[model samples]
Target chain A: MSLERIKIAPEMYEIMPPEYQDLVKNATYGNENRGWKDIGTSKELIEEHSLCAGCPESMAFRYILASLPAPEDTVMVGSTGCTSLVFPHVGIHNIHSLFGNQNAIATGLKRALTVRFPGRIKDVVVLAGDGATVDIGLDMTLQAWFRQEKFTTICFDNELYANTGGQESGLMQKGFVAKMAPVGKTFEKVRLPEIARESGCHYVVNCTVSKPNLIEKVIKNAIHIAREIGPTYLQLYTPCILEIGKNSMEGLQEMRDSEKPTERFAYREYISDQAKELLTEMAAKEKERKAEAKRQLASVKA
Target chain B: MSTSYQVLRGPEHFLPPAAASMGIRLPDPGQGHIHGKIVSEEEAMEAAARQFLSAKVPTIFPGPLVLWAWNEKAAHKATAVRHLYETLKASVTSTQQAMLIPMPDYRPKYPKINPEVEINPNHPNLTIWHNKIDACMFVGVHCHQANLSLKIIRGGTDCYTIAMCAQAGHEDAMLSFRDATAEKIMRLADWVKKLKGSVEPPK
Candidate 1:
């Protein structure tokens, strides 16, 4: 037997996936010394999938994947459009599903995993575009939430059917000229997070991939909360560089100023009764902890 | 961390999914069209390569597919497609290299290559000149890019399209090759460049 002394990064392994050492790491969620305790070592899991430059969907995808505590225990159900373009090439177990059926497929897969490998599946996420999430599969998505199925649903709202030459979708922002909506979409934009909350999701957030860290922190926390609670929903306003017709990064920046832009990473967490109770308990414990520290200091001084 | 969002401020729950379709048909309706074609890998490569090798004014359409399949991870690409153009430009005769057309969004990764041409969907009568091309080679793009090549095919340009995808039959692209990697794409780029200036047409 031959033995070789190869160096190992125990700290990096403790923080992130060991194989992700070569990636450009960001201090998003944790590592106070480096940054915060560290949310799963900011690594790009989606390798070699071409969308566009400064593509917000790609940014969100990387952050979401990095948030997972155990990627091997995760399975994703992805729907059609630009989102589907890259699913086949992802490193994790993924299903390149039909349009408007991301949630349905996710539900079925989760149920199957539950039956076959009980308590084995930790995460079952549905990543879909607005065309699928709002116009096409909205019913299936709502029903899945209503059923209280334990999963996280993220809607990458680029506001139009981007992959098919900028057609108007139900989720599109008003006044955008497109192939299908020449004059502009007349109907108002639908509020997805509100619907998800009403449909029984325990954690519903309306955020964007504008700031990498906020989205990363929100997604990481949302996933953890969704596992402990019921269904969780996030409407991440990721931008489409192609639709914007600008350089991808510059386009994302343009969103920050547009009359009705899309690059905003806004996080709204809806707490449930159970979560509220837990928070209350935590608050009480924290108070006692502070009081105990004060008394100990006083006694030592005396 | 706070970032700017310029749309409606709050999340709203409004219209139900398919309010009218609920009575008549399934909520989520598909086109009932799932396209699947099985072309032998050798056959696809032969047809695509032959057309690419023989053309007088061959047009190269490098889509997100090429970026997805071929771009080296730490290379100097404005997009993932920069290297393919650089490789092609490096290998081919300068006159031959000038005819390549990249999607408008993709910029050149390296210094040289007759500046990349951007194709727009809404251009007036693109089909007129689209008819003039001898062959269209598609690398790592989806239906949108293929649709442009299809225009040339529709123009009675007998030459077929050569599409390189992550997998075969994923879309309507006529030629499909599965498992395309950066190395494979680079090899293909080199081959296309080397084959570009050859004087004789293939038998």
Candidate 2:
């Protein structure tokens, strides 16, 4: 987003809301090096969200928004769920089409954007709930990958439909009792990251929001691969605290417990040859950029 | 008396104040109501039809979902929305593209859906009030955008607003119809047609 787009006219500055002014003056929209570390330090892309107080999805939104490599040129597509509640608060451009059609919308949007801005990188990212990704819109999601749509798809796998009274979702684990699954889910959890690999996603990662640094890396990798290679996917296990019978503060601990090395949500990533090469080159460039910046800082100090 | 709609409430105690601080338009959060009321599909449709018949100028803002359903019901849904507008003699307008980012030639024209032109959500109330529209219906809009737009309208103008959603109805709309299938929209069209037949059409 262009900072100029959000700038309030000087004549109307006193009339504008303070929070909006704060957003315009302090938001980290175009910072290349911004990450999860800027969560509370700077004005975030998401001014605020309406998610449950301790919802991990809320935290995931902040991390992902903060970690976007090109916030100025990125467009987010969201589906109907708790995630939708927060998109209005997000400062970046976003599309909330029909539920479960996020991937399809992103496919067209990415193509349109590419045509509109030739030779420029305009990232299209799809952020949806587990139900939208794995259950309701699974066919479209998979089809988008099969078609090799150049975009990133991130699923906030909260197990059940938390926004809709905790209904049973395909991402819900086996033998987990939910609203529809009164006797517990009878089937195994769908291995979406592996399916993403098989469905032609160039980069795939399965993890939780347990570590901010890892989340930042995963999001950047997914976006970078999709921009140059093909579709990429990130599955983040953002558990629903209320559904899991946990209180507000237990959300982070729940994610941490689920993502232990030996546990179900262990951090996993699969990178294709092209993606690996691209990442390596990009990493070297990033290192060089940092070193140069540090040298400039030291020279100034001297 | 039995209520036709369920009032949504946050599970946590602090969500109300916290959501408020985040600029969230709390719609009937089960304590003190902030925005509009949640009504049933029939109630919402009836209110919309009545508003259309009585208003000096009525408008229909069809969202993308109204143009196309997940099940490829776009043609039929568009037809029904068209029939509703034709029956009520309402002007039609919509947000051209779902994305809010400003771009040149950005508003992709969807004249097929009968919207002569599109308006941006950022200045929703100004466009509505400028057009002198007294009542408007939002059909097939994504819920979040619909919620934001509805709140902006409520806050700025006195235009009666109705939201017809495919999923659960929006609480922020003055009237909201949930499970908005093509047949349901056709039903609303018929109801409006019947109402228009009984009353003098708006000038």
Candidate 3:
């Protein structure tokens, strides 16, 4: 096909599977800015605190926090990036620390809270930039994974340092050039999911902000794993409009389109359901094994 | 077998007295089982000053190495060490080993201008733009500089000779060190610089 003919039309929603398109349409329709409905039980807890509504990162995070099942007494640890803006807005409690320190701080917080509250707080969610996690923060992030700290790290991989004027981050895909790499980037793109897996994170998820359903599923899974398995790493494909050279609307669209291939198969929902089933089975197996062990021990004693 | 070490005061001293604050605590120097004597803050300051005056080249580690550059006055070695240690500890894993070195007083040597060379005042999203710029500059400078050092070290005459001559006809061996160093430096620097000037910076 000719390049001109291949151009995507503005009105033509890309041809996705019928069921997938319907799901997208429904999800978008449901997102009617009913800010209150999205605000889960944590609304009351964070209502009194001054919201960091100014920054987009914070806005996105607040949106997610609102949707979470248990956001009560949750302490947020933000790195030295745009996400810190949410600290002021949430009003309840937060920490603004050094660059790439969010994961470590969140790890510590998760450990402390889980011990103190003992199943009261759900998970300590760390919001950081791709630069923080994949690059400078990699060691800390990897360490948290190895330690299996009970926390969820959400890396807002905008691919560039949005807070710092679109600098390329470790998460930036190959073939992309940044100001620092005017000559061109030399290192291969760092794949966060692969790295997280290598770092021993029991659950690692990659999703984009455009796929709210998928993002939500991944986030929910991460939270569940943080409660059950330990620490979970989630790399979120957050597009930086200013850095990624896309207008706000276009950026949002790109993010949405990025998920098209994966969404076609309803990957998020399928994975979530599968995980739930697997966990249930595992638990049953564990109980049976324990019972068998006890029976053998009693028999030996007799 | 007494190895001398200096104590640096890290940025943890500046952490707000809030529950959420990531505080700094000294890992019992004994934890690593290194038989080195931990020096006091004053001794560390003196040693750092000497190292700075001697023009000793500071080495960069593989992962993130926290360095304290005094923006205004000459930062004490102890202060820089403490900052680097706390920052590293708070950021990296306790198990992940990194060289925590105190930054020599660069302020007195190089006048501190806003290191950010590029700014986007007219960005459609002002808030996002400013934040991106700040983060890029902060991490970009260190990452870029570290990469540069690695490249120079690997591409140095001795390294080239060892690869090219010692391992004759081994193109892979000859190029490995130089290529890896160059790749790391260029990649990190490109990311930083792009964030500084790009119209649509990465999120």
Candidate 4:
């Protein structure tokens, strides 16, 4: 009759496309069996859906789901965009909201689950677009991080608005020709990764779609951290293939070679270090305070 | 029975539906007014022109020209705005201008006008550029970016105001004309061409 007894994670292989099943079979994050070298794996997820062929968004979406700490224990929140279009089609329980609300919804869900399941973990991930998180959803996204909510936000950064026929998003970099700025966009890219770090997110990663192996591995570690760490944001640099001209598998390599080193943003690991230091400092301070109180009590008794 | 597929599932296979975690985030009160007298299309363009002219300091272009416009209505309208900004040289007029969104295809066509700023406000170029503007115009800017731009300008020591959404809400203009139709936006373009019409590139 225990709540713990009732929980069961989904059978990921049955629902996932065959390509991922083969990919994840040997993949293990933070382990020696770094399944990246399994070159025989197919590029696409092999799902029957509306997303463009070689869509970077779809590729990252599949990899994140496959890398979950426990797929059966997962509840996905999809925002209104291309990701939402495919969320229901995937074999799992997912909640959909209008653009910009995915993180907000995921935060509330995590709080409720925490109280209900106590210390047990059920993965809650916000699968959304760059426009949703960096543009329309920025406020909600920042607030979620501000509160240190325990959840994972895997943002598919296709650079601009892809689902709506290619408009410039806040994520748009300068001098890029978009539907609105056909001549070219005049502004620079929003430093979303820096914002994630500044807003107190527990784990922040900025990587591209070219490396599914890296994407898979990062997500797996992020999921593990989310159970205890406050919040995690995985920004996958996926460009809309139709507009950008490269397939999803090679999106990273095809992306701006000049900007790669800067965009990669080697993992900060700031939150992990801070958390350890805070716990140690707080424990020491509490022990001393308690000891001082006990000494006062002994003196009074004497 | 020896199972051909060594299927192993995590204990969370039986988790409940996602309904347990859903909620909404409503916007806080906006300081910039959304409702007022719906000015005439002509009047809206006139106001937009006045805003463009009012820039005491060179205008700051905090951009995001969304390449994906939703419907026929949005598509044509966004194109019109693009045409107008190019005529205006909004980037060159900027004390600071941003680099392209890092998508190579989007960059090659447009001429480079200013040094690029990283997306974050803390970027030194962004801070320096944002600080100098006495007034800022949010042409083709989205809400998230509008908010960030507002935050940066507010932090500046000088008096600053938003020359909002290119149209200043003229009757025919989309609440903010930056996202509207060509004929509708042509009104502003006409006004700019007429007024700043005689002005030449800054030396």
Error of 4 at A30 (Å): 18
Model 4 chain A lDDT-worst window of ten: A4-13
Winner on lDDT between 2 and 4 is: 2
Clashes of each: 14, 1, 40, 34
Candidate 2: what's its TM-score on chain B? 0.65
- Among incorrect, acceptable, medium and high, the docking class of model 3 is incorrect
Chain B global fold similarity (TM-score) for predicted model 1 against the true chain B: 0.50
**How do the predictions measure up, each by TM-score?**
0.49, 0.62, 0.44, 0.46
DockQ of 3: 0.01
lDDT of 4 by residue, A117-218 (tens): 886667798888988998899999999989988888888877788877788887777787876558777778888877888888767777665566777767
True-vs-predicted CA distance for residue B71, candidate 3, Å: 45
Q: Give me the displacement of residue B94 in model 4, in angstroms.
A: 82
Q: How much is A247 displaced in model 4, in angstroms?
A: 6.7
Which ten residues in a row are the worst by lDDT in model 1 chain A?
A: A1-10
Candidate 3 has a TM-score of 0.44
lDDT of 2: 0.73
Residue A235 displacement in candidate 3 (angstroms): 0.9
Q: Rank by lDDT, descending? A: 2, 1, 4, 3
> Least accurate stretch of 10 residues (summed lDDT) in model 3 chain A?
A1-10
lDDT of 2 by residue, A23-111 (tens): 76787876888899998998887755678888888888888999999887999999999888888667778999798999999999999
Give each model's whole-structure lDDT: 0.56, 0.73, 0.43, 0.54
As for candidate 2, its clashing pairs are A1-A72
Displacement of residue B91 (Cα, Å) in model 1 is 39
Candidate closer to the true structure by DockQ (higher is better), 1 or 4 = 1
What would you estimate as the lDDT of candidate 4? Answer: 0.54
